[model samples]
Target: MPSLPPLLAKPVDLAPLWLVERLARLILSSVLKAHPDLFERLGDYRQTRYRFSPADLPLHFIVVPETRQLTVSRGHPPVADAAMTGPLVLLLGLLEGRCDADALFFSRDLSVTGDMEAMLALRNALDDSAIDLPSTLGTLAGPFSALVAGAARSIRSRALAERHATWN
Candidate 1:
C-alpha cells in the first residue's frame, strides 16, 4: 500500500481488514514454511481461536495459528479464547520489524485479555517467529510512499507520547 502526503490534513484511511489479514497470513505462511515443525511443538491447538482488535484504530481480526488461518471478524459473538489490543499501525510495525514486540508489551503499549495461557502462547510464538516486511513497495511510488509513511508514523508516535505525558 502506498501512502501519500497528508495534504488534506484528515484521517488517513486504513487498509481494509481483508488486506491486513492477507498480509499477516502471508507473513505467517512464510514462517510456517521455514519452520515446518512449529506446529508439532504447538501441540493440538488447532481448535483455539483468538480475536484481535486495534486499540488505537478500528480493525478487528481473528487468527488461528494451528490452521494457519485468519479471518476478519464481522462483529459476531466475539467468540475468542484470547484478545489483543493495540495500535493497528504499531502492531503492523512490530511484524514489519520496525519495533520490538517485547518492548511494546513491557511498556504497556499493548494489552491482552481472556485466556492467559492462550495469550502467552501467542506472545511466545510471535516473539519467536521470523516475520519481515519491506517498507518499500518496490515500484515507482515506493520511495515517496515510504517517506510519507515514515513521516506519518513519527507524527503519530509524538502525539501519543505527548498524550501519555500529559495524562501522567
Candidate 2:
C-alpha cells in the first residue's frame, strides 16, 4: 500500500518525459543485460503487451517482453494484453518479488486487468528471476556500485516500510 510521497512525485511529474523515460530505459536495460532470459520464462506470454500503471504517478510503463522493449509515457500507450495498476512502491515490490502479489490482489490493494493467464505467467517469471533491483541499479554507478546499492537498499527499505509516512 506504500506510495510515492507527493513532494517526490511533484518533481517527477514536472520533469521532462524523455528524461524520465531515459532513466527508466537505463534501468530496464540493466535488468535485461543481467538477466538475458527474463522473458523466456513467460513462454507464450513473452509476446504480451504489459502495461504497468503506477496509480500514484502520472505515467504508464509498457513492456513488450518478447522484444525486450519498454516505453514510458504520460499519454496513452498501446493496447495491452494485461495491465497492473498500483502505487509505485507496490509495483516496484512486485517487480522485485518482494511483495505477495496474490495477497495484495485479493486484499484489493492491487488491480490487475486483462489476460489473467498472461499476467500470472509474468508474475511467475519475475518470481523465478530472483531480481535484485538495487544491486542491478547499483551497477550503473560503476566504482560507486556498493555505496550506491547500500543507499538504494536503505531507501527502498525505508520507502516500503514507512509507506506514506516519509519521503524516500
> Which candidate tops lDDT?
2
TM-score of 2: 0.89
Which tens-of-lDDT digit does each residue in 14-76 have in candidate 1?
555576567656655655666666545555555578777766444567777677777764344
Worst 10 residues of 1 by lDDT: 1-10
What lDDT would each prediction earn against the true structure? 0.56, 0.84
List TM-score per model, in order. 0.57, 0.89
Worst 10 residues of 2 by lDDT: 159-168
Instruction: Give the total clashing residue pairs for model 1.
Output: 0
lDDT of 2 by residue, 31-136 (tens): 8888889889889998899999998888999999888888888966557889999888788888887878887788777899999999999898888777888898
Error of 1 at 59 (Å): 1.6
Q: Where does model 2 exceed 4 Å of error?
A: 76-78, 163-168
Model 1, position 26: C-alpha lDDT score:
64
